[model samples]
Target: NNRPHPEYSLKYNKSRENRLIAESSYNHVITFFEGLMNHREIAIPIKHIDFSIGRICVLEVNRDITQSDIHILKTLAKMMYPLMISDKKFLNLETSRFDYVLSDLMNNPKPNMLLMRKKLSNFKFDLDSNMYLLCLCDLDNINSKSKVNYVKQMVQGIFEKHYVFVFDKNIIVLYNNKNSFDYFKKCKEYEEFLEFIKNYTLSVGVSKLFDGISGIRNAYFESLSAINFANRLNCIYSKEPSINFYDDYVLHDLVYDFVAKKKLHYILDSTIINLLADNNTNLISTVKCYLDCGENLNFISDKLGIHYNTLKYRINKLKTKYFIDLKNPDSLVKLKLAIIALEISKGYDLDLGLN
Candidate 1:
């Protein structure tokens, strides 16, 4: 380290050992140097010039510099600033061009899907051969643009084989399904990646493995849905940083309440839902328990601490009061759908233990 003052020695220590050397008397009689430009300092023989962006040419002298030397250095630094800033902007633009190219190809589909495949092929993405998983990390709290870039690059490096991109302002990472001994092993890897950047309050949605470009669009959509709905479901239960797996949500298209629309709501007749919609409805809970207990009256009765006949009576009330039959399989399926829609609409009865 070249320091104008020797006392400014760069120091680091591990354990209980350290040294501070303050006696390096090597001053510039004839010293060739390269410097601290990135930190915005310019090292010179006599006076250190904090120059601006333009290129500077300094005429060297053997002796200590006078006031004239200081003036010339300041003048050169002032001239350099504009050119350096311009060069930086140009470099950023060039880096961003590649990002834009990948973005357009992934987001906007063209007439020829094969051409898009060709484009990705040229970029060294062998989607056809590898079992790929797509992950979209939602940046809920990180607001700095440079930090966002850094996080994206960090994840990309961690999964070096993956295609990492910032599409729609989310970090999208695509990587291969690794060689794992079991499901637990696979989950550990996923946990490692998420935990590494835990400093940033973000949630990630992961897609199940799929080969090739055919399902790429759907995988991206799946990841987006995961980050959005998973975190929401977690928040509903007072959990932080929800990570949703596409596979965990069976019939994922129907699981998200926001996507259900007015159609599913109408499926659950207004009368039946009203009967079950109270914030502390035992009837609704009994229904989910009944299903979970494999329709065994004894099992649910014991679990709910309800007398078997009493549970039977409440269940039969559907058929007698609303002409809805729980015993009938078709009717049961319809009721389940209706109840799901009802539960979503109200977001009520967390104590019901439906999940």
Candidate 2:
């Protein structure tokens, strides 16, 4: 395909030529393209580089390509192949170092901050600058090492100054913010990452910006918590990839912990418990939908696919029968917390510990 012109094409059987060269016990082949373009082509097979026939060093000249020229090219290719292998080995070694440091930092309950800072300094990371963590929760789904490396490379490309590594079946990215913190720029980079990973069903959880290397452990947990919230709430578990920030779920953090301890129901109003106990799930669903719709009856009716009057009737029944009022702000807050508890409880067992 690398021809001088579209019409000046050669019907060269490259594979047949390679077979002929292999059969002849020769390391190179010299082909004359005089009929096509008065050119001489030399193809030297790089035996020790990759695969069975490694690679080829092709030289096309308008004049003769001699055996001496082939020998020089082969010598250069052979010399360069070791450097290539060395570079790959160096890359793997560097990756393993990063992986080891990250595993120690994340898993150790009391990591030596001074030692960690000194070790990170070797990688040219400034301890005083802002640090951010991004957790790619679906890296486990990517079974190939090459794909994992591609994802790491993509993340590094998006955030120029970043440390990308995999841990516990997830990809953890530590983005170093050397310049002044800019929310818009961070968001743009996140958008670019999402665009690159759109093909995979990945859930990206971003931690809030932290200052100094001391905050790295906290940042790691924050990113993990954001991803956990996304999964617990079923907010962004879908066919498409989603990017969630820790700030977006900061308030939910406390509520999630409170409910996870199975302690939230102790203060739950009797009304919510009775409503949840009702055999008709629509009653509880109607209540949850009402709070979610911002107490707007019309919106609730449309979402629940019920008539406006019928929705009002249900609300009236809630007030009279269950002693619950949707209009009161205090009541609305209670209902919101109750719904959060209900949803989180569903992930455990059907029981909300109301008994």
| Candidate 1 lDDT for residue 40 | 27
Give the top-scoring candidate (lDDT).
Answer: 2
Output the TM-score of candidate 2: 0.63
lDDT (10s digit) by residue, model 1, range 1-355 = 2434332221111101111110011121222224422122222221112211122333344555566765666566556545555655522322354466556656775425677677666667665754544554634432323334556766776677556777665777666655421343465455766565354556777666766666666777777766665654554566666456777554434733432444434445554554554433677777778767777889899999999998898888766766666677876776666555554544422332222
Which pairs of residues have clashing backbones in candidate 2? none
User: For each predicted model, how many residue pairs clash, with residues at least 3 apart or on different chains?
Assistant: 6, 0
Off by over 4 Å in 1: 1-101, 130-133, 178-188, 197-199, 248-252, 255-261, 265-280, 296-310, 323-327, 347-355
Q: Estimate each model's TM-score.
A: 0.59, 0.63
lDDT of 1: 0.53
For candidate 2, give the lDDT of residue 165. Answer: 81
Candidate 2 lDDT by residue in tens digits, 250-300: 867766666667566565677766776563577777888876668678888
